[model samples]
Target: MASLLDEILFETAGQGPPPSKDFYQFFITKNEVIWRWWKISGRTEFRGTPPEEIKMFHHNFLDDSRFQEQLAVVFGNKILEYTLGLCRRHFDYLERLPDQLLLKILSYMSIQDVGRLSQTSSRFKKICNSEEIWKLTVLGHCDMITEDMEMLAKAMGWKNIFFKFYYKNEHVNMASPAEEEDKANTASP
Candidate 1:
């Protein structure tokens, strides 16, 4: 399996009523979690008053309460909570798959299954509802498709085209109303 890595930078106010801004960088990889913090100081005399602190630990350390307490002490409760949520989000394997591969996999699924999967996440919804996927579905299941039909698909969208052809058992005329009017005018002349 491929390893995943994610990094996030955020500002937090630490124990100050006026909200002193500090930068926190949280890096989570397959095997470790690293966090670095830097306090922003605006005083001219204390230009480098506070320095950056970096800490790294094995993934297993997250299970220890001592580690959590240490992180809370250093990053404040809100930052720690936000960082933990990022860590959890990084492990979503299906969401990390490439769109092309996901579309290929979805092509194999039944339309009903794809519809249900679309409701699961925004990414899935976009992929499941995309024209490319619907086009592929139409091409795979339909016996005959023509250039004219493809032009119609482009105008009406692949999903609409697919349902119209697949369920209604009718051919869609690709000519626009302007083209039909022109044909009528030429025939009258």
Candidate 2:
């Protein structure tokens, strides 16, 4: 089972182009066990809409519970509430949390949520660009920092912070054995 899943991931990762929204949608359902475990462990909540209706773009809808929680924080209750209301019928068991709680919820969302919520409104744009928020949300994660992420982080005034984290990783790899041997031999014997 693990090998089968690995083969699927390898195939997906090797796609000739960046995945389309539809591809991401299929990506979510491909790991049903993980989704189920997440639900049971309180990491996620499932909605009962027709599976056929689940398109990749629908990922932009109120799909990820963690993402919804973060959007509520970064965009404020008014917009968040309205957004929630939009998808409420489809996702009936969703939780309604207060804004105070919502702020902390930002930490729980995936970086994808940060990017998506940024497109929602100017208010969200502001919060998403907040240095403290980005720091808490994305730093220390494996090279998730990309050029676009840097642009977003810069808007939040954390470009240097992002670069520092990024280059540090590069430095570690560049300092590996072969480079170290050259550096050692080049120095005074």
Candidate 3:
């Protein structure tokens, strides 16, 4: 799996924070870190200046406080910390997993567990809320899912179907024909 991450590990680009107009981009790959910048200013002197770029190996990047400060000034501590983690080769393997596989994995988890997992990361949140996963969940909870139900699921959404079908059926089943049977048995005794 490590070998699969030989390409770009992390990358982001955006304009600097408030009070600044410059744009910045950075890329972290297995071999090097590349930082690029474009000067954006209303002043005439800065208008024609070409974009600048810096390329450094991961080892050099760790010791380059100047670039680290520039990164913080452009983005914030969150991006800076993530960049540093990438430099340290701390890759997020789960994040790299294909969404299809994640959907399969999430389908096996309970609804409560899936809800908690969604809160952990944006990727998990997306997968947890996806229609495909919800379809799987509905199918698993139902003893027999018919073609008409699947068509209805597509029209109304699987999550809504699960709630309406599962919970409504549960509530309907709960209300009282069983009480009559129990009463009859007790009256016989």
Candidate 4:
């Protein structure tokens, strides 16, 4: 019988398609992108070998506990995790993240991501609807938000829209008077 470690290695090795140009082009789904990126990054971690020296040993390669550290440095864990989750391809792992951390991560993704994540599951919908996350997720795209967007927005309710509108009015530029009108009004005054 194969040793436990051997089985693990074997299983991981066959879990993905070979890294060829054609395979990467057609077979690499959004879900697979994270899996492949994680594996490549994990291989990049062997201390003796530089990232370039580490090669594709097998289809499966990710085994890095410290991957988060590198990611945290580059994108910030808050954003990185959220971006991964928002991709809607890692729902299982994404759902398992701690609520606070997940919420922080959600804040870093775009409105479209938030909309997609809200459709993933009821639990995700609840978390995505929170004022803190929803506020940051939809920070500036009021006009782009449509009825489809409001499926998630319903969870947030009118109060959220009112608050966002209030903030937008207070802070964002709404309009500039026409130059001619301004000149005419100024002359009349």
Query: lDDT of candidate 4 vs native?
Result: 0.48
**Tens-place lDDT digits, model 2, residues 62-116:** 5677755644444346645655453343232112333334446766875568668
Model 4 spans with C-alpha error above 4 angstroms: 1-91, 135-159, 162-189
What TM-score quantifies how close candidate 2 is to the native fold?
0.27
Better TM-score candidate (1, 3): 3
Tell me how candidate 2 scores on lDDT: 0.46
- When 1 and 2 are scored with TM-score, the better candidate is 1
Tell me each candidate's TM-score. 0.59, 0.27, 0.81, 0.29
Pull out the clashing pairs in model 4: none
Q: 1-189 in candidate 4: lDDT tens per residue?
A: 112112112101122234421111111222232322223323435434422212222222234435435334444556445534433333345555678888888777755687799998898898877765755556454546677656756776643774565546754553445866887788994
Better of 2 and 3 by lDDT: 3
User: Of 3 and 4, which scores higher on lDDT?
Assistant: 3
- In candidate 1, which residue ranges exceed 4 Å CA deviation? 3-20, 41-53, 64-91, 167-189
Ranking by lDDT: 3, 1, 4, 2
Quantify all predictions' global Cα lDDT against the true fold: 0.70, 0.46, 0.87, 0.48
Alpha-carbon lDDT of model 1: 0.70
Q: Give the TM-score of candidate 4.
A: 0.29
Give a tens-digit lDDT track for model 3, residues 16-129: 887878898989989899999899999999989999999999989999999899888887889889989988988888788888888888888877799998998988888888
The number of the candidate with the highest lDDT is 3
lDDT of 3 at 32: 93
For 1-189, candidate 1 gives per-residue lDDT tens digits of 244333323334333223656555555554456655566668677567665554554455456667667667756787577556654553456777789989999989988799999999898999999998998888887776789978999799999987876734532545658999999999995
